[model samples]
Target chain A: MHDKLREHIEKIVPLSDDEFSFVCTHFSIKKFKKHQFLIQEGEVAKHAYFVVSGLLKLVYTDDTAKEHIVSFAMEDWWESDYYAYFTQTKATMSLECVENTQVLCLSYEDYKKLCDSLQKMERFFLEKANFGFVGAQRRIISWLTSNAKERYDQLLKQYPALIQRVPKSLLAAYLGVSRETLSRLAP
Target chain B: MHDKLREHIEKIVPLSDDEFSFVCTHFSIKKFKKHQFLIQEGEVAKHAYFVVSGLLKLVYTDDTAKEHIVSFAMEDWWESDYYAYFTQTKATMSLECVENTQVLCLSYEDYKKLCDSLQKMERFFLEKANFGFVGAQRRIISWLTSNAKERYDQLLKQYPALIQRVPKSLLAAYLGVSRETLSRLAP
Candidate 1:
């Protein structure tokens, strides 16, 4: 389990064995059944999870109670209500497991403590966070300018694995299109 | 000057005066005239700029040679071709001064060095990067689901200062709308 976590961190910044061990001590392993809510709207998000297995969805509901799927995370991906986590505000979105899931959970407090102790981990988190920001910005630009078919094509081209694992309805929601539109564009 | 820089960093992390001095030493102050290109496409982006005065626009050209305004930055805001800087690839966007601008520039190497030296600065960068990622994601979702008027309204609500600084044509491009459309929607 520690090896899996180490591998994930290594992709961002290679850590020495001692440093990896230090980080492992701060994280707690968590298991969730299908349809379990890892986080909910209106509550502060205290933990961010790194998925070791299974799938989870990040979703938001509007004032009218319409659900919009924002993102889906599978193996090796991290999920959190980042705004709530960073600002210590009530979450605007919810995280739900779409399948039985195993995750490495790191509390915000522990994560800050780890960053204070480990320079390499601090660099890793900063670089990874910046990369995530760029990807999110690109996704926003693409969604704004592209049509439904264009979005479907781009998603298939960029994240083929995610497209393969995610349900069409959820994908439609993420693309801001109807289920029928996504169905028609499905290859 | 150091006090202002410290205030900027303090928004993200509480930094001690000594730490702020260490971080500030890595930054070089630079000035750009209106319409001058701070960074150009096809070149590696060596530094990220933190605006101290005036405005800057980040623009990308599509296949057709049409320019798309991605963002505008004013005092205290950071702007760069982050995709290029992080990946060490050629920049896809160019940074241009919209007015005579003064900025604090820090290279990637110096940034890494500062993060290694000061844990607080590293945490500040990580937190700001995470906030940026979440904001970009929300903007993308809004763009995908909302109409032109809605996008305009959302932008007005979120970044009214940015809207005030940028020209209508540039704002339209940033919003992925035409100048005429934006003109019609504006009160």
Candidate 2:
């Protein structure tokens, strides 16, 4: 599990064995069963999770009690109610396991400590945050310009594995389309 | 102009006078008249602009030649074809002045130099990137949950000044609504 994290970090910045050891100290590991909640809306989001295995979804439930899938995290991906985690505020979203999952968790304090202690780690996070922002921007552009079929085709092309793994109903929610509409796209 | 940049940076991380002087060395200034292009699609994005005054729009034009407003940048905001700027690739979008604009420009090389020389700048960027991601995520949620009128109301509530400044057509483009639809909502 720790090896998975070390590999993820080393992709962005080479970590010396000693530095890797220091990084390990800042994270703890946890596992959840399928359908278990990692974060609950209205609770303080305590940590950001790096997936070692399995999958998780970050969801927002609207005033009408409709669920919208904001994002998904698979192996090697990170998931959190980031605004709540960074601001130490109540979560407006929830995170739940889509599969039996294992993740490495870093609390906000530990995140700051890691960055303060290791400039390389800070650089790694900076790159991640920049690309993360870019990805979100692309999604917004897709929403502006793409029809439902185009969105479905783009998702299928970009993340074929995700398409296979995620349930159709959830995919509909993520695409902001009805399940019936999704069936037509997928079919 | 440098003082405005200093104030923006200092909001996240305090810099000594000497440090601010060093930071200023990494930027050059440019002024653009209304409707002038700062970045054009298929051209390399050379710099990220820090707006000192006036307004700019980042636009993505579809194959049908309809333009979608990705975002608007105003005083104190940053604008660029960021994916192209960071990756040194051709821009897929164009950035143009909405009002006669003055901006401080930082090239990718200078941006890296600033971060390498000052850990405080890296920290400041990380915070900005994180919040930028949060802001984009919120916009995605709004799209998934709100109708045209609701989105317009939310935008008006959040940035009253921006509503007053930007043209309604651009606002409609940004909201992924038609001008006819926007008129119905705002009127």
Candidate 3:
């Protein structure tokens, strides 16, 4: 489990044995069954979960009680109600397991401690955050310019595995299209 | 000019006088008039700009040659085709001045230098990137769930100054709405 995390970090900056052990101390491993909520709306998001296996969905529920998919995180991905986690506020979003899942969880204090103690860890996080921002920006652009079919095709092209793993109903929600519309696109 | 940059950085992490001077050395000041293109499409985006004053519009031109507004960056904001800037690729989008603009430009090499020399600088960037990601996530949720009127109102509530500074046409483009539709919402 820790090897997964070490590989993820070392992708950006290599860690020696001692350094990897120190990094491991800042995270704890947890497992959840499918449909379990890792973060519940209106509660503080105590941990940012890095998926070691299986999958999770980050979501927001609107006033009318319709759920909107913010993003999906599978193996090697990170998911959290980050606004809530960083600000220590009640979550406006929720994270739920899509499969029987295992993750390494890091609390805000531990994240800070790791960054303060090891500058390389900070660099790793900075790279991750930069790419995360870029991904979000691309999504925003797609929403601005693309039709439903184009968006679907773009998603399929970018994450073919994700499309295979996710249910059509959930994919419809993520695309902000109806099940009927998704059928037209995928059928 | 450097004071604005210092103040922005200090909002997340403070630096001493000498430390700030070292940070300042990595950035150079550049000014542009309204309607000037800071980043042109198909050109490498060499700088990530920090706005000291005035406003910028980052735009994407579609296949039909119609421009789509990606984002607006006003005073105290950062603007760039960050994907291109960081990756050293040709920009697919362009950045233009909306008002007479003064920006502190940091090249990719200088960005690395600052991060390498100052742990505090890396922390500052990490904080900014984290919040940038959060802001992007919120926009995605808005796109998924909100009507044009609702998105307009949300933008107005969140960045009243930006709304006031931006022309209605650009605002419409940013919202992925027609100018007539925007007029109906705002009026």
- Interface RMSD for candidates 1 onward, in order: 1.7, 0.4, 0.5
lDDT per residue (tens digit) for residues A1-187 in model 3: 8898988888999999999999999999999999999999999989999999998999899999999999999999999999999998999999998889999999999998999999999999999999999999999999999999999999999999989999998899899999999999999
lDDT tens digits, residue span A24-65, model 2: 999999999999999999999999999999999999999989
- The model with the greater TM-score, 1 or 3, is 3
Candidates, ranked, DockQ = 2, 3, 1
- Pairs in steric clash, model 3: none
lDDT of each residue in B109-152, candidate 1, tens digit only: 89888877777777888878988898887876676457889889
Off by over 4 Å in 2: none
Model 3, residue B56: C-alpha shift (Å)? 0.2
Residue-by-residue lDDT tens digits, candidate 1, A52-155:
99999999887677788888889988899988887778999999998899999989998888888887888888877998999887876575457789888998
Work out the TM-score per prediction.
Answer: 0.94, 0.99, 0.99
Q: How well is candidate 2 docked (DockQ)?
A: 0.92
What's the ranking of the predictions by TM-score, best on top? 2, 3, 1
Q: Compute DockQ for each candidate against the true complex.
A: 0.68, 0.92, 0.92
> Could you tell me the lDDT of residue A111 within candidate 2?
97
Off by over 4 Å in 3: none
